[model samples]
Target: MSLRIDNQTCYFDTDTLHERLPANTVTVITDSDKPMSAVEVAGQRIHITEAQAGALTVAGATAGRRYLRATDGDSVI
Candidate 1:
């Protein structure tokens, strides 16, 4: 027997430009190696699926819901 769930996997990259974050935006978790800091989560990150990332922002995101960025290239994700 096999069980399957309709859920998409997500992957986000750090922002190379490091621009300032706008208002009403939410950050997603990307750091799988280590737990993300609360402060970092609030100020950066975009909770978006890989498919939805192309249209969101950065000329790649696929959905507006996944436009969050770290505003820095060296940002720990």
Candidate 2:
């Protein structure tokens, strides 16, 4: 998925992003290779599908959800 944060844009693979997330939280697992890629959109932390990611990449932004940066406070841009 492509997300805009702090005036910069970053793209992440939906699968890789979710694989490191905890069961019911936006926080990622400690062993995540790229923890700085985790994001929450419309309060959704782990259920985003590949199709949705593709759609977001095409449209830039969804109807009501705005892309937030990685919870780690690091800039991927």
For TM-score, the strongest prediction is: 2
Model 1 spans with C-alpha error above 4 angstroms: 1-44, 57-77
- How well is each residue in 17-58 modelled by candidate 2, as lDDT tens digits? 523322222322121443322346334554344454454444
User: How many steric clashes between backbone atoms does each model show?
Assistant: 19, 0
TM-score (all chains, Cα) for each model: 0.21, 0.25
How accurate locally, in lDDT, is each candidate? 0.32, 0.37
Backbone-clash count (model 1): 19
- Relative to the unseen true structure, what is the C-alpha lDDT of residue 15 in candidate 1, on a scale of 0 to 100? 50
Residue 20 deviation, candidate 1, in Å? Answer: 12
Tens digits of lDDT, candidate 1, 22-70: 3124233344433321113224543334433333333321222322456
Off by over 4 Å in 2: 1-39, 42-44, 61-77
Candidates in order: C-alpha RMSD to true structure = 14.0, 12.8
